[model samples]
Target: MDCLSLLEHVIVTLFLAVLISIYMNKGREEFFRILLLGLKSLPGMQGLISRVLKGEVTNFVKQVNLDETTKGGKRPPRVVIPKKGIPYDELREAMAKFKAAETNHVEGKIFAYTYTLFDEHFQLQKDCFKIFGEKAGYSENHDALVSLFHQAFLHENALNPMIYPSLRRFETEVVSMAAAMLNGNENATGFLTSGGTESVLMAVKTYRDRARKLFPHIKEPNIVAPITIHPVMEKAAHYFGLKVYHAPVGPDFRVDVQAMEKLITPNTILLASSAPQFCHGIVDPIDKVSELAVRRGLPLHIDACFGGFMLPWVEKLGYSVPDWDFRVPGVTSISADIHKYGYVVKGASVVMYRNEELRKHQIFTYAEWPGGLYGSPSMAGTRPGGNIAASWAAMRALGEEGYMSKAKELMEATIKLKDGIRKIPALEIIGEPCMTCFAAQSTDPEVDILAVSDVMETKGYKMEKQQKPSSLHFSILPHHVPFVEPLLQDLAKSCDEVKANKTLAKKGSAAMYGMVATIPDKAIINDFIVEFFSEVYKCN
Candidate 1:
């Protein structure tokens, strides 16, 4: 189209949008209420909208000290600090007030944080924080404290570990620990990265880079992964300019190994599987995929980020999990997160390979630079010392015995939660999930699972929702073991409330999710999410 026509189109669009905005603002109360009501009228939108609204209303009620009606409130939610620096004592008082305000949002109160906070353990962690935090904060050498205490002890960046001997040692130890956990032999070698996503990206990058080097005939590099593989692989493929081939999963939610085998082609560089996928927590058949990778001379990666730390202990505790780690013959690499189940502070994960030669492809090096020769093993250049230190501290504190015991408790809690959900006549658990994470689908198609989620939220339980099958999810933790009975009881009561009084669950984020799913144009939904992210970082 001509520039004139394009300008005319833009003006018309703007005019209509302004009219809609004015209408919406004029009927603001009606607009929001109806928007939520419309979402609840749809299936999955009810769950998402319900969660969001519950969060907003709960905060409103607490901050304003309002009753159920929210009438005649003295204070608003906004409380700002002074622009100028306060005296240390005044600052401490302000910090205490803020901490008190946040303390109300503690463990067993909500979900989504994922970490289990036991009363005794929470106190222990708090005390530990108080002790280590002050000293660490006051330390002269930022790098020295980090190097002394952290699990990944090296202060030097992994990008050019050769420049720093201590960092190289830390990196090697972390990788060795991960490989040993995965049943890798002497030949196995690996690298440390930021998190699970980076590990997955490097695996894709390594395979893609290797394909270009070895197979001159292959024009386009393609990766075949089960639908359950973390979205990171797909994202890496998009960013790195490679094609991704998805293999379907069985009703059990595990990857269909035969289907993946058939899909393998000359262009396929990496075969991917999750030890236990995110959605349903079902482990893919890595043995079959490993064999295929061997026959096809393709690299295979096992993503165990979710279940990594827990699974090792669970196996020791006597769970019949299949071999989905480095023990499997043709598996070239594995990615496992220490932060999640390892009870590490955060920002810790390990990516392992069969040999250092395979890992060399994952590294980025530069010989010519004004800043001198630069090389990084993973994505980030400057790593956080505090995170590394805290993670290492946490791991040492937990030890093998602590992890195993915690894993046992978590498994028991998961089983109890599963059983409780099964008893609810309206819902059916999706599959045999071996780990803490389990998903549920509504049997009565008319009754939205999101609606059930809304009811649960009012009772102070925050559950996650899922797409594709339209379900609600749970990720069990050690602290949850104590509250399993209460949680299950609440869930049962919520289910009853949902069935009897549909209006009770009629308000929240559930509505938004349901509405989004039914919308035929996914591009619009994607655009909305992207815009949401953009608006989040925009200056107020």
Candidate 2:
């Protein structure tokens, strides 16, 4: 065998040996768990897992939606109008009933939706959708059903961007907007991605590719980020074959720059800090990280998918926002989601680099394919034109002035709520969020935050609960701003009511969340997640 072939074989052998060693060291259970996680990272394995998860999630939704004891028990007509259409009024009544059932299921009841609950904001969104929905997808070039669908199709096949020029255009605009928001200049360039996860994936991939080209001798690539950095980085590391070195966070939930500095090694491809992490809405030390990256010749990525669109305005409105953008010298790339705070529909996000040179690492090229020569700037095969249009529309509609007003309203409401929550002795605000989204925990040992969340669920708040600290999350939207005081008042009352009341029977999906958190074996949790997907896809 040639030297290169022999070297590859040796590397594969070493990889296998390492796996075996880990399996031996950690025992079969832990080893298999990690191995399965590793398997899930593989492209083939990822697709399989995704399908399974989708199916399970679908089935779960069906079951919950059709639960006989609940209000939405009546199923839709099975055989879809095989005979003839019903009368107009009859059809309208049926539609209304169905709408009511769905509304009952969602109205002030679901926390995960992250929209305004029956307020002007909610009405405004509906009005926007109503006004735009019919006309939204009517582009002759691409007859998209929804604006989201259009965006979904913009580059649905990014593997062949030449075939879909619109995707390139959409991507270009998205990146330019993201970079401008992050203070990137003419030197900056970027691409559109599926979501925050894919954006993170591409950033890691780009850095790895750059490392491969520049420092070929460095075999092992590692990413350094705070513990609070979204798990997507870990997912990216796993998918692209890189190691993760976590830096600890302070009580304020911000990354410790000193600890991060100590963790950087010769193989470190990327340094990361969050504009504001998912769990707690606290921005990391981006300026410090950027300075460090510059000194070390490492590429630093600021993940602002959660806070990118909001923070800029927040900073402009005179909040204590830090320089977590391209303004920093070494800040190489940034990921921002137009879907989240951008108030556009989902399936839109951007990954931007400080300069074209660094961005070159993000492009994928293929010289050989049966169909044709293929190349893509981002990960996806196809892009969505409607989403791009909708996002662009959303941006245009909500210009700087509009966003500033929204930011101001949201900040005021958030501060009021934070102060109100702090007044309650049992519950404490998790961190000082610059914007609306924040987390809270129960200080009283007897009071389970999950239980409190369950109680809030009963009250129709539908807040999300978290583990690893056992807290509840709240993403305050512009819609929720007005209800902030009332929500806090209800929350305080809920705590009192729960404290005074008897232990009632557990009802609804809150129990499942609690159960998931308590499971000691992570494999079982994985199995449950897999099973959950299996259940989701069940039609009956």
Candidate 3:
């Protein structure tokens, strides 16, 4: 297409868009009309429009990450390869500095990312990590990236278990261990996924395929889950060709079982809930939902990705957690992350079914390939053997006794943290969170929760802002055991600051979070999110 012709088409499109926007949103209509006016007399209007969009979108995105992902709102220098090779020592020093600059999760300064007990404990996992591969190669200095033994199986792949039997054993043993934690029966079996999202994806694929065979007449399968179901389920539904009916939660933030049942149609293939949903960290009424699933003759998938490893130990600590595992009569499948409460490295989760028959649906196979037979357990090809090994090693390093001891400290800290939050008159926890994780909201309207998050960031505390009720998510791990009181001090101070200065809500980054929480027009918020991410990914 020629430039002038493209410009003419754009003009026509803008005119039509303005006319449509006039009815839906008067403000946007006027704004775009001004843009169109600027487009009229300008030479090379295409470049002008491109610059306008780049300025508008990238600026908002960069501003959003100013205090978070980026420093001082300036784009970081792009990394490029060098013509001359740098010494391994120089590279090690550079990487060590970079690693040093990372958030000291050991000091409990951050939340939502690293999950660990102590610095010394995690170094063991790092040592095991070297058994597979490290980008800079193994260092002779043991202390460089934590004491490393010998590196072996550097070229190992999990795709063919026959080739590397250790990878196969590691994965299967991890699955077995995860299944036992969730109270799986003798027949319960599953596969290792990259993480919670992929685990959820596999569950969706498995249940969808199962529905095809059991209920062939139903062409359009759907899933019935609570509104609080993790966004991974949203991704799963979008990726798989299925419809989802989201039932609202009750006042306590637990999914209303009756509402879920009401949404279930004859074509509903699976019923879904979380073992403490992510945002508020409240366990959905899985027992009640499981009963509903049994009555409806539908498969129930429990997303224990966040709470899977935490809940069993929480129960062992004598907390009265609701039955969410295989002990629940109708629970069919579960996905739990070994990375989260399991205290392993990133990208490891297990999705297990009630029995082997249900798990078979998750496997993929092809016989007629020219490259010979092809078979995959999950979505990924050439699965990393390191992840499987690291996960297994972490599990062995922390046996049942070790996990229970960690859980005791973790929950005790959570109790202290919850008590401290309750003491703060302006802030209140959203629900009775099952694990050390919970979301907090502003009880007083004068206090802007997002602004408090901004202040908390300044105080060197990482806070994940949530929108449903203008709250903040705290994923307290063992790292937080000693810092509970200190975090609460900062929290109280941040809330007071927000209350004192009413203008903080309109300040940097908080405005973006506030828009999502306070804005009634979800359509506009959706557009902002789409544009924000689209511009973020565009090359500078």
Top candidate when judged by lDDT against the true structure: 3
TM-score of 1: 0.70
RMSD values for the candidates in order, in angstroms, are: 23.7, 18.5, 21.8
Give stretches of model 3 more than 4 Å off. 1-154, 517-523
Greater-lDDT candidate between 1 and 2: 2
Candidate 1: clashing residue pairs, number: 26
Worst 10 residues of 3 by lDDT: 142-151
Q: Output the lDDT of residue 322, model 3.
A: 88
Query: Could you tally the backbone clashes for each prediction?
Result: 26, 37, 1
lDDT of 3 by residue, 1-540 (tens): 999999989987987676677746777767667667756547898677767987896677556432223556653332211223334355345434533544444565653323454466655655565534567665543122221201122234678655545566667767877777788866778999889999999999999999898899999899999988998898998999998899999999999888998898989999999998999889999889988999989999999999998999889889989889999999999999988887766778999998988998999999989987889999998787656765665665556776788899988898899899999999898878878789999989889888999999999977898877788998888678878888999999999999999999899667877556677888988898899899999998
Model 1 poorest ten-residue lDDT run: 76-85
TM-score, cand. 2 vs. native: 0.69
Range of the 10 consecutive residues with the lowest summed lDDT in candidate 2: 76-85
Error of 1 at 219 (Å): 2.8
lDDT of 2 by residue, 86-114 (tens): 23344234333433443232335532312
